[model samples]
Target chain A: MGGPRRLLLISNSTLHGGGYLGHCQQHIQKFLGQNVKRVLFIPYALHDRDAYARTARAKFESLGYGLDSIHEFCDPVEAVRKSEAIFIGGGNTFRLLKALYDNSLIHEIRKRVLEDGIPYMGSSAGTNVATISINTTNDMPIVYPPSLKALGLVPFNINPHYLDPDIKRTHMGETREERIRQYHEEPNTPPVLGLREGTMLLVEGDKATLQGVTGARLFLRGKKPTEHEPGTDFSFLLNDSNASNL
Target chain B: MGGPRRLLLISNSTLHGGGYLGHCQQHIQKFLGQNVKRVLFIPYALHDRDAYARTARAKFESLGYGLDSIHEFCDPVEAVRKSEAIFIGGGNTFRLLKALYDNSLIHEIRKRVLEDGIPYMGSSAGTNVATISINTTNDMPIVYPPSLKALGLVPFNINPHYLDPDIKRTHMGETREERIRQYHEEPNTPPVLGLREGTMLLVEGDKATLQGVTGARLFLRGKKPTEHEPGTDFSFLLNDSNASNL
Candidate 1:
């Protein structure tokens, strides 16, 4: 189906002791490839669009690719239609999804990435919106979108910047694991991928692989979450029927 | 109106290394007083209603108050009407709010607490819904409610189990302070009270006092958050006009 949908979903933009997008530089560069000369950026998650654009532009340019934010374009849908690659940076997932819906870019971007086969890259909130829903996000509902339904670029949901429970901490707030389990308690939810900091899932065609230094956790509805190390094949999750069987 | 609407909004039910509700026993006992003999409990936040109700009923019984869960009754609205006091224990904010809407108890509970002057108590997720909206909750959006609009028993919003930023940690997820600031960036957001664990807000009529062992941080739009001690008065927040001026 259209030469396999290409996507690079990163967990966090900046890892500990690193600059913005510093940790995932090589992976992003390789994902873009030599043929792609430009990238379309979506910086709607944060309140300040101009500042977000500046940070992203500097990093993308350093890697030899010109970057233009979709916010700067009068016709954002048209801009997506002509982009070589699309990158949505991290921020609040609700705000990001709301902006995507408000701009009416959901279907246009979906078609561009899924049907036309353009490379799509997302970090944190950007990565979250690429999944079935943002129900598993670790963010406050500062703003309400029309719905929790996301772009559905992938078959499963994602919890970016997923942190393990600090057994020593006295705070009674539900752990990240407990929160995701609650999501699964609701009927008919898809699988959830808990992407730790400095980790990402790279999708090329029908194959998806866990990539980065840290490991990711795969959570199914009725089973205990299984740990997956870096370089693990997550391609089974790309197919709905295959994922359900797992 | 009705002898200064009474509410005991707690930050958490269990303090670190403490038994459930053990830390807040005295405050709860004082709030309920000798006048109220029974408490109607809402334990819809967690998946197991029976288990939640049992935990709550045991705790309330030890405090010399008879407790019955709303789920046990055929008429939840009538249950609210006849209840001497109400206690909503915490688990997940979204799930609690969704269940509240599903059972059509928002208006009923509001009338019982605000208009009838019955003492209403909440912990964590429960404290979140007592505020204007659950926009500042620390919990995940595991379930989507009909609206983020909560019971609005209080004028301001709350971030319960609020933790200060851990300077030593390398995690890139937004700190509680940063998340609340992002909420403030949205238009017309209420002032957020960062209720640290082992702390709570006791609302008596027009007066709200920061109680428990720890302090709280108050956040307002376009201003730095101010630290408030345990005995600090927050009556100004009860009046929307007064809160805006501050």
Candidate 2:
């Protein structure tokens, strides 16, 4: 019974933390429990890990943790293997993905979190990795390079930082809708999770609930984007009773 | 002044034979003299237009042109536009450009065809009008929707086949070397030429040369592809004098 539902996802603490910090902290506490033991931070690529460590340290401290509370590591694999709950902070998703692929940590993380029942939390790229494909990650493709294959943890895709169409004027890339459309074209592609900022998909047992701000969108092909408010549970999507390991 | 420069480009027509029968005979003969009127073909994109057309109509005949008969779309646009002869054969340069863009075409075609006083030719989407970009001839972006801009002819874009890539994988999607690379990066794009079948880039000055055979490669970036022969004229690259437009 405690097999496939041991996940502890935390939003990236340093990603423009203002109002979103409180929301993420609350969610983290809710998932990891108040008797939190050990938390590890992984900063694999950036030349300066102190900045990331400091930001994470501050957020964790404000959430009722010690000053020297969280342990940080440049080696994600080692940190992921030893921790009770692993929190991956977001900076550059490409950098994070590269680090994961480079150190061969994805297989380990998948095995431990999904197969062995460890609490795993992610944000931004971290959250995106929860899905089967990186097709929905809201990052420019050529900014790094294209890696068609991703860590297929969940059956659906994830679009972090999902914004409305008007936001297209600001970014010089394909809209979230356009990219998702491309994904759907691939024969038998998965569903997509368009998670706006502050939105999280909480999976416990076999039930997955939508948490945080309202007005988030879930985009799927041959169907209109169904809008949902906060407290709206998407347990139907995670109906493992009939789920196939396809 | 009488025997000035002109161009005649065909999208895809096989000298050896095998594939779709696009506008080859009438267009080729329209531009080339009797001696130079044989078809030019790029076998890469599956050159077979001539054979198909000839066999289909029964009144058709083989042109039997080789690499010498066909030029790589990598020559100076001016030289291509002003040549005593010109003929662009087809195959997928997007397939061809796996070897094409590295040698560079985005810049050369613009100079030769746009800046110089030479006639230009194209067929299918080969009559490129995808100016803001240069690669959507075969691929259609929207469905009876937005008015997509292209390379502005005389400052516009061309969309040959105007609606081909969308329907067939025989032609890849609109992600050609130059188009995909430039689409998400550049702003304030251009107009285009959506040259469908039986269409051509006709500049009837005093003399017209036939280039592009089998089928034409679309120019979505700004201008047409620079014509070249792998070993003789160029080594899949244009000299500095030619590669200045992109």
Candidate 3:
């Protein structure tokens, strides 16, 4: 299942003082490389597909690749099957997942990315769907999906745009760390990777490396959360057995 | 089915510079009155039921009421059937709703509160469950519940501890207002009330009043969100017909 998988799971598209994908432009260019001429964009996370596609197209074109949205195609499955690369942008996680199931593109997209060895990129909501489940997402349940289960491209779950708690503020809502701890309280749950904004996890073949400016925090069940800096190899997370004890 | 419905739905338990239930103590005592002696506590939203129960018991006791957690009882449904009043504190909405279904207390509690007229007090996650659904909650989906359909004690949904977006921050996450808008995009959804901290809605048989230090915002499907003051009459929301147009 892990064979030929290529993914660049980004925490967010826009960082502070930056435009869309401005923070990670160089990384996106390198991941797609010189061979891929065009990319298929999935903009179902948001309500306005036409506008979302236009934004994504403009961004991808500036990165030296042609981009077409799946919503524009008559057959989304066929579009996914023939796509050189797939990029799912950020928005509402539940809406994005519901659309994926509703469009029947889950299996098709998964097959193309995992088996066919296509380059895959995701930010925020997109990064959430690339993991085992959307249970760890920060988005509101604006809509209910058929299931929490996602693409399972990664063995673990992800919390994108993860924010550290401001101890100075007395807001009683559960902190991002506390929410991840709650997820671990459930039975047989996997480790949760909290990818801070401006950070990403790049996976190629069987290797996963943390990339970008900031670091990420990994939470294992019944253990203190550990922080990993940029350039740390997270390939151990790719193995299901390594996540068993976690 | 509105019958003898009585409820006090609070946004959050603790506010800045306040202890647990500190800001809304007077309203709690007034809502329960001199007739009710004991309050049944539901601590299911948290991982440590005993700890949650202890904190709640201390608060209720200080308000001159006896508090016993449902977990201490062998039959939770029977406990709800015989309780004088109910108080559900704040935590994770998903975990709390799952426990309500798991313990088979949904039907029993609804009967006691709506028909029997036992005063019902809910804060945060509790307020979320008292509404039509938990679709507007700020909590993560730590666990999957059987359904999003909650107690439906109120005709509208609630977004508790609702915070206004800070224009100063460049975080890409959806603002609280935007999340509720996305919820309306779904068909047949109810109106959403965004309750700021230190605020609550007090509902009697035929009347509902917004009472607290701050105010609330009401969002209709296609209309602009309107702000309401503390003393605004929200009893219109109790009527199903009023919500239909909203």
Candidate 4:
């Protein structure tokens, strides 16, 4: 067994014309399973912490699962320990990493999700934290997190809401392709999984499958991005070879 | 006079159809003046060290100024100390900051520009480093720098190549405006100056004026984004009062 590396890494929480978490409700419910009655939500990415928590709680409650935001708990580390399922929603990645590091919940959450076998699900910035580091995130570094180190639930780094290069665009802003190419410059940086919006990766121990109709992009240094079709087996991405792939 | 805090902070290096440093070459030449004959170029923002320097040298040479890239120097700190004028070209802010810190040139460069009054010109990521921090940069954090602390040449932070929110765009990613708003959520984070492409800011002493044809957006927390027309005074952005103004 590849240990309990269960993950529901979503590219975005909300899609075009969909309510918050609307598009992925069934996938989320199915992923959590009937056994996990409660989930600890991490809503630190947004400014309105309470409102973000409430929104997630509403969705979880409707699915017959309870969601309590870590912000409400007296001790966040303790909350991670007791959480049967961890659901991290999308927002600013820097803010989320800042909160995670500030509360010293990084190790506790990593242990809970990767070792104890608690089902871990994340969207956007949430999915960003599940990877090796927050390096590939598109969010502005609004706040300084102590470190970019994040829970290494996945072997490779993830770029959620991954966008393709729009050749027609005249904007000088670096395209998604160029940005990831720059990421490859860093020595020892991991390969990136470009999870497009409406696309999600479902991990059941050793295997990770692209769950949505849309395909995801995989980026390796010095190589053109290769598209991974839905249902493509990405188990090789988690192997020990990845830690040294760079 | 605190020497001459002459700053030519450009929003972007190039426009759509323009050549490298196109659309602003005349402004750069005018800003540098006849006295400054040479410039020390910091091309750390680009992944290719030598190629970036060569390209920049080509442009500076055509402009009748000799450009010496810091990468070639034996002691980078010495190079900064001896630079007649400094030109920081733009690419990746994280990479730029990382190189600066790794070489221990952050303080030296800051002193050369802010205190020594070296004529400092920068574009895109280059302008980002001159701000309070590189927190608002659009580049991916491919590598972790020791800290986000950058040259506080200006009191406010800068968001270079700033694009406005497009209401018609259905992408779930946070718009430029929304991202800056999220930056405001940080308690001590400085106000961000959203500099649109093709525009630049000219700072002389404590006074700063928005240059180029387009106006710039000023984002102060709890207040609507107010536009400052080109040639309007922006000295207030550098005041001690600015900290509390937000």
Candidate No. with top TM-score: 1
Reference contacts preserved by each model: 0.93, 0.00, 0.74, 0.91
lDDT (C-alpha) at residue B229 in model 4: 79
Instruction: Report lDDT (Cα) of residue B189, candidate 1.
Output: 80
The alpha-carbon RMSD values of the candidates against the true structure, listed in the order shown, are 1.3, 14.0, 1.7, 1.6
DockQ, candidate 1, comes to: 0.89
User: Where is the poorest 10-residue window by lDDT in model 4 chain B?
Assistant: B237-246
lDDT of 1 by residue, B105-160 (tens): 99999999989988999999999999999999888898889999999999889899
Cα RMSD of predicted structure 2 = 14.0
Candidates sorted by TM-score, best first: 1, 4, 3, 2
Candidate 2 lDDT score at position B172? 14
lDDT of 4: 0.88
* Model 1, docking class: high
* Candidate 3 displacement at residue B54 in angstroms: 1.3
How do the predictions measure up, each by TM-score? 0.98, 0.50, 0.97, 0.97
lDDT tens digits by residue: candidate 1, A68-120: 99999999989988888899999999999999999999998899899989999
Candidate 1 is scored at a TM of 0.98
Candidate 3 lDDT over residue span B1-246, tens digit each: 334889999999998888899999999999999988999999999889999999999999999999999999999998998899999989999999999999998899888998888999999999999998899999999888998889988888999998888887667777899889988888878899999998999999879999998899999999899999999998888999989777
Question: Candidate 2 on B1-246: residue-level lDDT in tens?
Answer: 133334553333322233434435655544454544233232222234445233433322443322222233445333333443323333322333322243343354445445553334333333332133333433212111112222232334443432233332221112233333343233433322333333344444322222332222333345554332212221111122222233
Candidate 3: count of backbone clashes, pairs at least 3 residues apart or interchain: 0
